[model samples]
Target: MSTPAPEDCGYPSPRPRLSVEELPAAENTQPIRSLEDLAAGTFESDQELEEFLAFTCAERRRDVA
Candidate 1:
């Protein structure tokens, strides 16, 4: 079974869209927010990366529920 739409729809008619210049400026978009620099460090052992490759899939995925 199916139903048919009326000849007139979409709340009778739609209003004209506002131009960009006429639109109000958003507060969040005003200024660029600064982000803190991330802390980075080298591995304790140069071979650490190579050793990690030997770890099982379970070991690679930490804090599993």
Candidate 2:
């Protein structure tokens, strides 16, 4: 079996990829202070926990960049 090319896979390729230098800087971005806050067990429900995890992932990604 052969793998399909990006175009043959039936999804549109992202157009005009921008380099890091081409992207504009965000003025108000803030670093997350603590992952410990997510582990504090204060969430009342599973949905809250999922949202917090998602937020943590985004924060970590921003911090790395």
* Best-performing candidate as measured by lDDT: 2
Give each model's whole-structure lDDT.
0.52, 0.77
lDDT of candidate 2 over 1-65, digit per residue (tens) = 99887888888876776666555443344446788745767889999999999999999999999
**Model 2 local distance difference test score:** 0.77
How big is the positional error of residue 21 in model 1, measured in Å on the Cα after superposition?
1.3
- Cα error, candidate 2, residue 39 (Å): 10
Q: Point out where model 2 deviates above 4 Å.
A: 1-41
| Alpha-carbon RMSD of each model | 12.3, 13.2
Per-residue error at 65 for model 1, in Å?
7.1
Q: Model 1: which residue pairs collide?
A: none
* Candidate number with greatest TM-score: 2
lDDT, residue 51, candidate 2: 100
